[model samples]
Target chain A: MKFTINRSKFIKYLTDVQRAISSRTTIPVLTGVKITIDKDGLMLSGSDSDISIEIYIPVADESNQLEVIEEGGIVLPAKIFNEIVRKMSDETITIEVGENLQTSITSAKAAFNINSIDVESYPNFPVIDSNEVITLPTTLFKQVIQHTVIATSTQESRPILTGVNITIENGQLKAVATDSHRLSQRIIPIEVPESLKENSYKIIIPGKSLIELSKIVENQDTIEMMVTQNQVLFRAENLYFYSRLLEGYYPDTNRLIPANDSTKLTINANDLLQATDRASLLSHEGKNNVIKLTLTDDHVELSGNSPEIGTVEEALNYIEATGDPLVISFNPDYLKDALRTFGHQNVVIGFTAPIRPFTVVPADDNSDIAQSFIQLITPVRTY
Target chain B: MKFTINRSKFIKYLTDVQRAISSRTTIPVLTGVKITIDKDGLMLSGSDSDISIEIYIPVADESNQLEVIEEGGIVLPAKIFNEIVRKMSDETITIEVGENLQTSITSAKAAFNINSIDVESYPNFPVIDSNEVITLPTTLFKQVIQHTVIATSTQESRPILTGVNITIENGQLKAVATDSHRLSQRIIPIEVPESLKENSYKIIIPGKSLIELSKIVENQDTIEMMVTQNQVLFRAENLYFYSRLLEGYYPDTNRLIPANDSTKLTINANDLLQATDRASLLSHEGKNNVIKLTLTDDHVELSGNSPEIGTVEEALNYIEATGDPLVISFNPDYLKDALRTFGHQNVVIGFTAPIRPFTVVPADDNSDIAQSFIQLITPVRTY
Candidate 1:
């Protein structure tokens, strides 16, 4: 397409769309970014099959300085075109399509002529037929994603575990993810229409897609979400992010969390995180990568040992330790990840037994919605 | 052995010594850092056979807060020890050698018991028999190293070309390095001892070693260099850096520089560097990885082409383009690397022929040292 725009402002939109483009995509045309310019504005689209992103630069925004010389469209190689734009030695760049599907990109005295694929060859974006839009506070939604996504399985052995199960019912939206060994759940209040209150909506979205969506929607106040049978769309002011939904049913994880505890330890999340990190250093050099935590009536201690590297022990500082004395061993990396989500807040860790899964929840979380924002980790059997 | 010191201050010394320690070394003991606590102070040493570093933390330096309880020595695993010290949860850390060659490292309530090797098993550092020390200004010497090291051959086909040939005589030190295709030479004035004026000393120091030395010697005003038959020692206030010399004869590169020129182009070094970076982007994607420069009486242009990708052309902004009209092709990466050394200064490029090597020299250079700094690049014979 024949168009010129501010180089820096255009780069910002290009980077957002590029998140959906992967160099390793099997579809060759998917590796290219589709650029369409009309009398109104310019739209850039990128997709890697599972996720697609589209950003529009409207002509009404004077800062963009967008001028459409001709109404046309073309798809250029994303990787090289991005490099060319970044390295161009000018404040503004002009891109024009020429004969034989050759495109000329010029900025200052530098000009590059690269091959282009016809825009018609690009696959059409999935049509999100549902007109019902669910508007959610960006900050609360981001927090829910950040809290639960960590427990999502990165391995593809169980593909359904790779996605976070999100359910909206009555006035609350709940997000849960579990990789069998660890689980995280967070619930937040939302405005649910009366028509959909009876029919709860449940969708499993890939955790990877949510991360990209979170990053690109940073400055926006709210995001509008629309769902179809097989696809979901998150729309901001001028940005649209679409992700494919996993087809299989998510496993029921409610029974996995313990209802009662025999022992409890209250400590600052960051303090415990640091001790676990130090203890794990030696364990990481060993075969099992596990650390032990011993809680007594009067003291609490963490220790790790490696036959080749030696041993590390730390008398942890805790606010309180109560109930029956207990000793537990687990992969410290799981606890570290869960603790990070709590930041500087004090967390109460509940243990049912030495072998059963333990739960960590904010100590000061006295909310109306009980058991919200809880992380559970299955302890390793050291004995 | 036992000593307690400020954690941050001790970590600084440990990091410097760890630079010389590589986990991939054949000698297992070399992977450990040798720590010797004497009545005077603590000495930390690490070596990878090719390079050795020893940093002394004296008791007189109050910032170290080093208190030696006993006089003994041991070698602790470098990587794990450094990590433990960094993650220790206290302002000060105490390291003590307990019974059975087991060392106890304690900070706050955290304790680590790690296995240690006998100090006698660690190889001793080489002794430099020469008493004569050559002092060089740190800033100027660092500049000389930076200007020439980029041209040093990374390939081991010609082992001698991997080291910079440094010669000192008549109150001047000259350093030169080449990868055969490109060469960089830099000379700086130094105060030569009266006794050493009669004889010129030539030594080939590995470029890799010089890069490390430069990074560690930043705050020092001057560095004392002592050369022996097969080793070179660079000593600062509390640091001693030793590097093995390359045992080979360096090829004479003076004859390769052209004495006369038929075409010349003068431009700001930074301006040309940016243009070269842009041009190289396309060439890097191609097979030959070469870009062409055309210099005429009025204009200078740079262009690069990739058969599968496309082509890029930029009319370079120059202060002067005079002499015979010419077109030359060469690897833009080499030119970019050489141009970066000149920074913001204007440079005059001299060319004798399209196939012959061309030289780039600072345009404002009128020093009596004649060619104090110069970069030469051999052009590719592109038809």
Candidate 2:
């Protein structure tokens, strides 16, 4: 492979693909980024066993900086290649395959002769049909994923729970994730025409994959998401992100949600988040990591206790009481996750009882804002 | 105890004191911060076995805002106290001890009642003698610690090697740290005439302790250092940092450094660091992390390799070449550490050979600037 390309452009693509490169990969070749130069452009690929990312830099960019002399391929150590390209002291860097499998990279004040791996040893990436694609605004997709993915279970006991269940039904895209202790669901109500709505499309994407994909995407462009039975592909302008889908069926969570609550409290999202945060400091030290919430005729009290350390009780003054006052204890971390995921200006939390799960929804009377979104928090026994 | 103080002021002190508190202390009371209330002020104390930090918030500074009715004391869990104070929902937070060893923390729309431990269980901070004191610009002390501390051996094989040796003689502060493989020496030329000049003192301050002390002293302020036989005290404005000095005689490192070398290379600090960094990406994966620097009549080449992975050779454009051709291999990490510690813009590397030790000094025309500091790195045997 012999070529010269804009340094920043290569660096940008390297970063995009590097997210998929895990230093701890069992397969040695997987740790290397496969670089190929064809008639059209240059391609950089990085993969772990789970996910692979590929980014392309076309020769004909605005800078007219990429010039190709010979089209070939090589697999360079991902980390070394990345560092060399990043530190190249020129606007454009030149790379040429030398004898004994050496690849020479030259710039202004530096020249690196690196040994390249045989591209044949590297595993082939999964190829997908390009036709079945769902397009969405990159920024909106980022927001929806950010809001839903945090609730995904990090525990590997149930691998499927580590993924966010994304479903498209009736011109709406709803993403739901839960660890069974708490759940986060966000419905992007952006109008999709009938042709773009596919009824058979439902897939669960790993939260880690979604996070890396989110990093590779830009707000200015539209991202194409193509879902297969086993894999999901995200295609941006110059970057392609691929993630493996969870095989098991996601739980039917709709039945577990309560329709209405006997007691409800409305509070500023930031204020309640901060209060619960303080309550969490004490509860976080507890074995169950549970914080107690007590509602009375005048105010609501948030408290937590660690048997060895101490107890903390914080009262929220802005309380509107209607039904019999309620006191419930749940994981402060879960509640924090719910509030953080929603990131709404104001939220209304409705409680059924101390043992059952509670519901937190947008305070504004717009179900559209709360469309397919539902978070459930199971109270931990604090007694 | 009852008092209300500015939230920001309390948080600042809490942050500093938090540095002295560790969660894994063997002493249970060390996990708590002692809060004492008096007619003069409120004292917050946090300590680990080796180091202790204390801050006093005077009542008069509150300008009538801080109201203290009762004078009492308690040891609040350091982490909990910090979290509560940080997350309190008011501009001014009021903390008061309630009946039955409970502490009540009140803010605008919130009130936190936490359990407090008896103050008697907390260890009393020893008062070090303040009669012998040396004062210097905080910047100078901070720079002295920063420049020489990196060379301290991380291994506990020899406890004394893990501490930076500070020898105050003839009004000059000489700092030295070495891991046996490399040594960093820095001498201050300024002469301050006082008791500091009359008495010469040498003490080994634990590397970790100096790091903590460096944190307390801001670059802007002048700091006072009080030396006791067993402990060294660093005082800056409102914050006082006391650390127990390591007891042992530091080994003489002066004999290891060569008086002169036949071959020397002057290079840009930033460029050489980056080049070695690129070489390091491969060398770090090797056994001894060896990277070779080969200086020819024209240029310098940095190369590193692993038997299984590959090799990388980066050529640096020579600014000027006059010394005899030299080839030397050293642990890239040690060289990188020494390179980072040298604050000079350019570095002059004095070399002997592949198996010999080398010196790196500030590349300055002025003799005084170069004479003040020298960093030595021992070459590794790649064979």
Candidate 3:
């Protein structure tokens, strides 16, 4: 196969596909990116064990263009191929495959002959059979991943907790993730498919796969999600992302959330975030990284202490506060993460004493006031 | 003792003094910054075994706004104090020393009760003595250090090579540094004392100290430098900096350089740097990090290869070529460093042969039109 492609176009697709290629994969061939040139365009594919990304570069006529004389395929080492394409000065790079899988890439003043592995050596990706499919706006999908993915457990000891729990019920798609210490839940309304009307299937998707899909769907208009028995395929315009679903039952988290709270606070988002951030500096060195929040008349005082490093106190202005004054201790890092997801000006935090889990919600971020989302953080006993 | 200083001024001074404060110092007192409050102002000092830094945050007003009710001093842990001062929300933090030597620093909504050690426990700084002193713009001092310090050896096997050789001869101050493989020499005229006109003293100043001073001095204002028996003091406005000098005579590097060469090539500096940087991408993984340069028929080819990772070749543009057609190999990293220091659009490289040493100088950035400042690099024999 011999073809000349625009350097920038090839570079963009190469980088997009490289997101899934892991250098430390147990499957050695996963480290190589598969490149195929045909009459339509050039397709590049890369995958780790968990996720796969494929990007297509169609021949365009505006500027630097590509021409294909033959149809063939080869797998090149992603790490070295990326560095060469990024550093070459030529506007266009010509790639040709010869005998013994010898791949020659030539630019303006530079030429490289790289030995490539046989494309057949790569593991054949499972063909996704689809009975259920749903379409969602790319922006909304990316937002769902961003809001809940940070809450997933990084430790794989309880393999089930490493994935985000996605559930669709009563015309709403809710994404929930928890590391046993804190939980984030994001709810969005979508046209429910008639096939999923029986019961909500607890689909647990690996956090890493969602992160890669978020990057690829960032500025796209729409994305088509095809759900098979064991795999999920997210197809955007010319790029296809596939991730294997985790095989386990997600825990029922609905019982952990409290139905109501005794005292509540509406506070400016930035002020609360700044106060918690300052208090975190003193608590980060401690064993649990816990910071205490004390609420009174119209303000909340955030305080934290390290036996050797001293203590810090910050007064946060609140929109309103009621009921008995309450004090609770929890991981300030969880609150910091929740604060970053807020695009609105104010947030309302609800508490039921120190023992029960508390929730933080956007004050006016909800279209329907009765349907407000909440982030529940478990309190740590600071004795 | 008590005083309130401007937030920006205190933060700036704290950042400068923090360079010498290491977290793992053996001496517990050395890990702390000493604060002395007297009628003059507040002095903050930090030190490790290798270097010491002292910065004074004087009262900012037309005169002195520092009201000293009593004179007192204390040493507080530098790392914790700096973090507290940096994270405080108040524009000006009020600091006061208690009867028990405990320090209380209060900002808008925050207060810290930091424990402190007695100031008498802190090590005494060396007395300032000037045998010879000269003054130059801060920019010139930084330029001098940058030009000569990069070639200093990092390996401590030969301790003297780890320092930059500084000598003053006939109203001129010159700096030179090398690790036997590459050498950098820079000279500029400076006024010397009448008593120091006998001969040049080739004293090796530790390269690490020069790098520290370069970071502190940031402008074109004149800074007075005084050289004592074992210390160098740089005074810039109200700031006084002191650094310890190395105790060794530097080697004479004059005879190692060739007087002139029959073959020379003037090429664009940017083009040469890019070629070397690209070649380094592969050579860096190889032993000795070597790249070969072949000049033939007015064209230069920069090439490198790793047996397992393939090879790369590129034709480099030459502005002028009178060099003998030959191939030579050397550490690409040393050439990269020399290129950074010798900042010119085009540079003329004079070569004796493939196995012999060579010199590189700016095409237009000559210290003198007739006598160009030359950097010499010894060639490596590659079979």
Best by DockQ: 1
Best by TM-score: 1
TM-score of 2: 0.92
Ranking the candidates on lDDT from highest down gives 1, 2, 3
CAPRI category for model 1:
high
- Model 2, residue A153: displacement in angstroms? 2.9
TM-score of each: 0.99, 0.92, 0.94
- The stretch of ten residues in a row with the least summed lDDT in candidate 1 chain A is A192-201
Residue pairs in clash, model 1: none
List candidate 3 stretches off by more than 4 Å. A61-64, A193-201, A297-299, A369-372, B60-71, B193-201, B369-372
Q: Write the per-residue lDDT of candidate 1 for residues A101-177, one digit (tens) a residue.
A: 99999999999999899999999999887757787899989999999999999999999999999998888889999
Compared with the true structure, all predictions reach lDDT values of 0.94, 0.81, 0.80
Q: CA lDDT of A28 in candidate 3? A: 78
Candidate 1: tens digits of C-alpha lDDT, residues B1-383: 89899999999999999999999998999999999989889999999999999999999989999999988999999999999999998999999999999999999999999999999999989998786899999988999999999999999999999999999988899999999999999988898788877778899999999999998886678999999999999999989999999988999988998999988888999999989998998899999999999887678899998987799999999998778999999999999999999999999999999999999999999777967999999999988
Q: Considering TM-score, which of the candidate structures 2 and 3 is the better prediction for this target? A: 3
TM-score, cand. 3: 0.94
Taking the candidates in order, what DockQ does each have? 0.92, 0.55, 0.59
lDDT of 3 by residue, B250-313 (tens): 7888887888786888888777887788788778756668999988876788998776666778
TM-score per candidate for chain A alone: 0.98, 0.94, 0.95
Q: Write the per-residue lDDT of candidate 2 for residues B107-135, one digit (tens) a residue.
A: 87666677788888888777876777777
- Model 2's chain A TM-score stands at 0.94
Docking class of 3: medium
